[model samples]
Every structure is written in C-alpha cells, then in structure tokens.
Target: MTVRVLVVDDSLTMRNLISAALRQDPEIEVVGSAADPIEARAAIKTLNPDVLTLDVEMPNMNGLEFLEKIMRLRPMPVVMVSTLTAAGTDVTLAALEIGAVDAVPKPATATPEAFHDLIGKVKTAARSRVRARSDAPPREAAPQNYSPDPRHVLAIGSSTGGVEALLTVLGGFPANCPATVVTQHMPANFTASFAARLDRVCAPTVTEAVEGAPLEPGHIYIAPGGVAHLETTPGLTPRCHLSVGDPVNGHRPSVDVMFDSVARLKRPMTGVILTGMGKDGARGLLTMREAGARTLGQDEATSVVYGMPKAAFELGAVERQLPLHRLSSAILELCADPAVRSVA
Candidate 1:
C-alpha cells in the first residue's frame, strides 16, 4: 500500500523539498502540506494521512506542544524534521519521548543522499506503531531479593525506536543497579541531551561516555555519537575508551565496536540487542556470548522494528528473547544468578 504523507512546516521551501524527496519513493505519496499547527490540524482531519512529517520549529506554535496535543487526542505515526543545532537536537529528543515515531535532522543543503535518507525514514515511520500518550506499560517493581554483582557490566545497543525502548528498560532499573553501557544510534549533538533526559527519568545515573571514564556501579554510560567508537581497555581499572575510526556497519560508535570491546574485558558481562532497523550488533553479541556473557534480545512482538534483535537471535547470539516489559527483570535476574556470574 502507498503511504500517504502530510508535510507540515512554516517554510515553503522546506515543505517543497520534503515533499519532493518523499515523492521520489514510488511507495510514498504527498497528500497535503501545512504551514503551521492550525493548518496542520485541519489537514490531519481531512487528509487522514498514513504518516506526518512535522517540523520542530513553526510560526504559530512550536512543534513540541503541537505533538503533545496530537498524541493525546489522536495518536498517529509522526516523524519530526529538525535542524542539526544543539537546541534543535534537544527539542527533537523531547518530541520522540512524546510519542513521535522517529526523527531526521533537516539537511543544511538537501543533497540527493540526504533526500534518500529522509525518504527512508518516512517509510519506516509510516510502518511503526505509535502508542497513545498515556499508554505506557506498567513496570514491575524492583525485585527485593536481587543484588547485582560489582564485577558485572551490562552493555546495550539499539537504533530506530530505541529512545522510548531504552527509557522503558532503564526506568525499571534500581538506584543501585549494575554499571551499564549503551551504544544507541543517534547524532552527535543529540547524545548529550538524550543522556540528560535519561538521567532525569531513570533511577540509575546516566551520562554520555567520556574517554577514560571509570566504569562504576549504579551509573550508565552512553556512547557519544558521530565522534568515536566506545570501547573498553582491560587492566586493574576497566575504563571506557573512545576510539576515532572509520564507520563500522555504516555507523560510527557502532554497537559491534562496543560489544566486542566489552568481550575483551576480564569481568562478567551481559549483552542486550534491542529494536532497530539493521543488523549492526549481531556479530558482536555473538562474540560476547562466546566469551560466556549472558545475552538477551528484544522479541519481535514488542519491537517497533525487529531487524537487529532478529539478526542476533538467528545467529545464536541471544540466549533469550523477551518482550520489552520483561527485559529489565530478566537482566536483574541474570545479574544476581551465581551460575551466570561464575562464567566471568
């Protein structure tokens, strides 16, 4: 089925450019365009498009406010179009938490490749499931009997629908949970803001990974995007290392790079591959499993896109596949198990 799209942006040039790019995909149709939220509301009611491309900054009202209203009143798949500035990145991350399906940075100058990428995001967003603004799944309370091992490190990787997925999983962690590392596919400017948001909402402290930062319990480190791959160095003090290198699997700070580095460490580890569009982390997860680390993958039923987890499962890298809501509990259980810890 052809995906019907509504373009909402204050700039006529942007609307035209977005529309032109999406139209290049034979499966996508530009049904309408709107200059502001007022116009967008009307277009949404009449056109009832399959997907929406919303600009983060608009004339009458900002995109964030409008997005909240839409998600509350009528939940639907929405992709945010934002600039690459710091302020824009912050707002875009907020939009994702408010139930937007995904986001794309507005190109400074729309090139053929940029248009192709935009078109691909729109197509993926059209197929994604958008939950209602208030429809969060009930979280299980932290297990009273569980105590995490100080020597255990939890490493996670995700893409596409990861912002909310990571939020759901990490929000369930206890204040004194195990030390963790994450390599989510995000832009350079967005990682800091993303980490800040996670810090506020999660029980464990979260920060963007820094070079030589000591991996400590109860703190979570996120790999900085676009700059370097997050890796680990083995020694008396196992610390986070950022390495500048060519993009692996078409991504800098690739999940494979992080997982492979974690595999080299002497301490016990747990690897998780969550919802994403590609198979970037499959091989690395396999390496972790081969090194006696417990590995988990998010199951298809709960995944927005199952590509990464599916790849890991098929490769025999993931020992268990669980739904989104159950993953946090499973991680805690694995961490507390003496049998699992002995493999380290």
Candidate 2:
C-alpha cells in the first residue's frame, strides 16, 4: 500500500530534503508540504495524508502546540523530526505526549542520509495506528500510579523503536506510581542514553539499574546494555542481577528473564509487552500471567512492528490488548487502587 505523507516544517530546505528522501521509496509518497502549523492544518484537511512529519520547533504556534491541536481535532499518525540536543529532546517528548507516533533524531549535519532515515521512520509510523485520547483526563507531571496498594510491580520489555515508546508510557505515570523495571534491547552506549532520556522526560526517577540497588515505587530502573539480565531478588526489595551468563531468547537483557524474575519474586506483577520486533518477551509474559500477574500487550494496530506483542498474545500471555494512547490510563487503572497489592 502507498503511504501518503505530509511534511511540515518552516524551513523550505528541510521540506524539500524530506520530500526528496521519501520519494526515493516507492512505497512512500509525499502528498503535500506545509511551512508551519497553520499551513499544515489546511494541508492536512486538503491532502488527507496518512502520516505527518512534524518539526519540533517551528514559528507560529510551535510544533508541539500545533500537534496538540491536531490530536484534539483530527488524530492520526505523526512522526517528530527532532534535533539531537537537550532542548530538542524535551520538545520531542512533549510531542509524544501530544500523540506523536515516534521520534527520529536529526543529525547535526542534516545530510541526505539523515533525511533518508527520517523518511524511513515516517513510513514506519504511517503503517502504525496512532489515535488520540481525547476523553482521558490530562495526566499530571508527577508519576501517578493506578493502584495505591503497592501489591503489583510493573515489568515491561521492548526493542527497536522502544526509546520513544518507553518515554510515552512512563511520561503518563504520576509521582506515586508503582515500582517498574524495563528491558529495552539496545547496545551498551545506547542504554545509558535511553535511560537518561527517560529520566529527563518521565516523572519517575529513571536510571540504569545498578547491582544491589533496591527497587522503589515511583522509580524506574532500566537494565544496562551489557550481557546481563535484571532479576528480582527476595526481601520485598529487588536487586539488579547483571550477568554475562547467556542470552535468553537470543537477548542478554531478555524480557523473558525480567518477566520470569518478576513472576518468581513478585507474583501478581503487571506484565506489559510494548512494540518490538522480536519474540523475546512472549514466554516471560506468559509466566507472569500464570503467576497471577495482569498482562497487557500493545495492540497490533498501535505497534511499530507487532512481533513481540503478537507472540505474547499467541502464547496466551496477554489478558488485554490496548492502543498506545490508552495504555497509560489502563496501567493507572490497574495500579491506582490502594487495596491492590502483589500476591508475591
């Protein structure tokens, strides 16, 4: 199927560059172009493109503000074009909260290759269904837990396009959310960067898990990129287990490893398998479910690749499937009850 796209940016050079990159792929067609949000609004109405490539910083109601309006008025898939800078990162996160599908970091040089990558991301985002949550109450800046009882911990796993997905899910958390751990398949250098990115965007304190550190509510620990798996230890407090032992499901920081640990250490934990391209988390999520954990999977329509969640669903690991927009609220609803506590 041909994926139609609308490129929105103030820079004519950027607009041309993006258009050219997308045209190279036969599957992607540049339907229209807009200089700013105002023009983009009209273009979106006229062109009715399948996906939108939005710039983070633009004149006349910045990209983020415009994106909010678009989500409110006409929700669709949007991929953000973000600079690889601190401030740009912040704005990109805002875009995700406003219902952007994903973010591609723009290279400093802005070479042909950079725009080509952006085109690829746009195409991928276009294939995914990203709807806006118009009725859900606006999330607060603090980490909010759906359950107040502290009985259930949340163990999530993802890969490939996980950076943006993780941030979006965590950003919806309130200040007093449940203890959470994540395993996003990535290389050594990228995990730290990803964790730092989440720390900056998410309300909960996020950091790369260190050996022996206790898991705390409102704190999120990301596994390091090395050949180690994070497992929950005993004592009502969990410790990080970093090992070069072996790759589970062809992954060092395997989702199965984390999920299994949660099932063993915190039965009745909540298992969330987000967008990914592999089956690493499927088995582990099943174990969690069997252990009485509530399991949630990102629906196929909202997934970037749909491989992981599909596998988990086939394995009967998922008790519920939801889109990206509703995931946070669903998680909150599962955890917000003060009487809810983990059976583990």
User: lDDT for each of the candidates?
Assistant: 0.88, 0.78
- Which prediction has the highest TM-score against the true structure? 1
Query: TM-score of each candidate?
Result: 0.91, 0.70
Error of 2 at 316 (Å): 1.6
Highest-lDDT candidate:
1
| Residue 146 accuracy (lDDT) in model 2 | 42
| TM-score of candidate 2 to 2 decimals | 0.70
RMSD of each: 2.9, 5.5
Candidate 1's error at 157, in angstroms?
A: 0.5
For 1-344, candidate 2 gives per-residue lDDT tens digits of 89999999889988888888788889988999999898999998999999999997888889988988887888888888877676776677567656776777665675566676566567667666555656543433433224444655788998745665676688888666778889987644456667787888777789998888787787888998655888877566666666556888768888889898889874347899999766999999999999888889988876767889999999999999987667876776676554654211
Q: Residue 233 in candidate 2 has what lDDT?
A: 75
